[model samples]
Target: MSEYRVLVVEDSPTMRQLIVFALKRIRNLQIEEAGDGVGGLKKLSAHKFDLVVTDINMPIMDGLKLVSLIRNDPQYKDVPVVVITTEGAIEDRDRALALGANEYITKPIQTARILEVAKKMLGV
Candidate 1:
């Protein structure tokens, strides 16, 4: 199987673990974790990731800013981003999409749903 790298950015350790656990079920996937958006950006600079799954409410920098930065950076501009957050409003969803997030998932997320989305995004 081809190897794929995925980055999970979330301030909550439990949430991050949950995401990583779900992602681990996919064959040949290498997962990386970041506590916040700044760390996520650092990882992005150090290595290329096939997909980025981030939570919006992180400290230092929020996921929206990260999405915007990723969209602006030519190297990562084409990379797929999935925003997972507690923000369920239409505006929040629209803003994330406007900032170039490929997919938006609200909190209380199902592992199966996230797994499905991740697989679809990675084309696994």
Candidate 2:
């Protein structure tokens, strides 16, 4: 049985793979991947997840927009979102958090950091 479901939204295949690998270490997780925020939205609409991990910059849509949509939409409201991105600026972190991301980690990402945040966000 799955203990949790996590959606990883990243445009880069390599980055997405890395995030998936980290999430898999948590055990009992059903992980889903999306190429961008638009795809993330589609996945969210189709299924329920305990967490969302996204990258800040991407084509079609971005993490900020995803967070806003998730936070404002009643269907997705209260879901935890973690933004892992190369955009390490203070403003970028502030923006993502203000938009309702539960956690923000700038690249290059540490394996333990991602896993730690994921566990904390999921209450595991």
Candidate 3:
């Protein structure tokens, strides 16, 4: 079977590593990491990814814009984007959902939940 791919976008190296660790539980995944939304976009355009896990606040670009862009672009419109953020504000979650994020995960994360979401999103 071809390996499924997941793109992770976050400014913090530690958070990125943590997310990768959580998601690595899924076998045969080719995970890509981006420091921020701009970098994420570049990678997104360059590759076909099955899922995207991103943080909302970052330099250059933010998760909201990324989600909007993904939704606007026909090529990636249907891709599942999971927004992981430190903010637990209701507005933030609403905005991300409105922008087309499939899931919004707050910080202080439960790794297992992320894994579950990933499996459901990828139908793995």
Candidate 4:
């Protein structure tokens, strides 16, 4: 089976590493990391990803802008995006959903929940 590619866009090093480690549980998953939205966009243009896992707060660019860009791009519109944010506010969740994210996950994510959401969206 081909490895599923996942792009993780997070500013915090610890959070980024945590996400990478958590997703590694999925066999045949290839992970890519980006520090912020700009880096995320650059990575996106360089390669196709099966899923995008992003954090809401970051410097240079944020998850919302990145989600907007992905949705706006014709070529990348089909790519599934799962927003992992600290903002648990209903408005934030609604905004992310309205921005075209396939799923929204709050911070301090459990490994099982991450796996569930990933499998649910990617149909693994």
Top-TM-score structure, candidate number:
2
Off by over 4 Å in 4: none
What digit string (tens of lDDT, one per residue) describes model 3 on residues 27-120?
9999999999999999998999999999998899988899999999999999999998666577877899988899978888789888988999
lDDT of 4 by residue, 1-124 (tens): 6479999999999988878888898888888999999999999999989999998887999889999999999989999999987755667767888999999888777878788898887788
Worst 10 residues of 4 by lDDT: 85-94
Residue range with the least summed lDDT across 10 consecutive positions in model 3: 84-93
* lDDT at residue 98 of model 4 (Cα atoms): 97
For residues 58-102, write the lDDT of model 2, one tens digit per residue: 899988899999999999998999997675477877899999998
In model 2, where do residues sit more than 4 Å from their true spots? none
What candidate 1 gets wrong by more than 4 Å, as runs, is: none
Clashing pairs in 4: none
Q: How accurate is candidate 2 locally (lDDT)?
A: 0.91
lDDT of 3: 0.91
In model 2, residue pairs whose N, Cα or C atoms come closer than 3 Å (at least 3 residues apart or on different chains), thus clashing, are none
Candidates in order, TM-scores: namely: 0.95, 0.96, 0.95, 0.94
Comparison by lDDT, 1 against 4, better one = 1
Angstrom error at residue 47, model 4: 0.5
Residue 57, model 4, lDDT: 80
C-alpha lDDT score of every prediction, in listed order: 0.92, 0.91, 0.91, 0.89
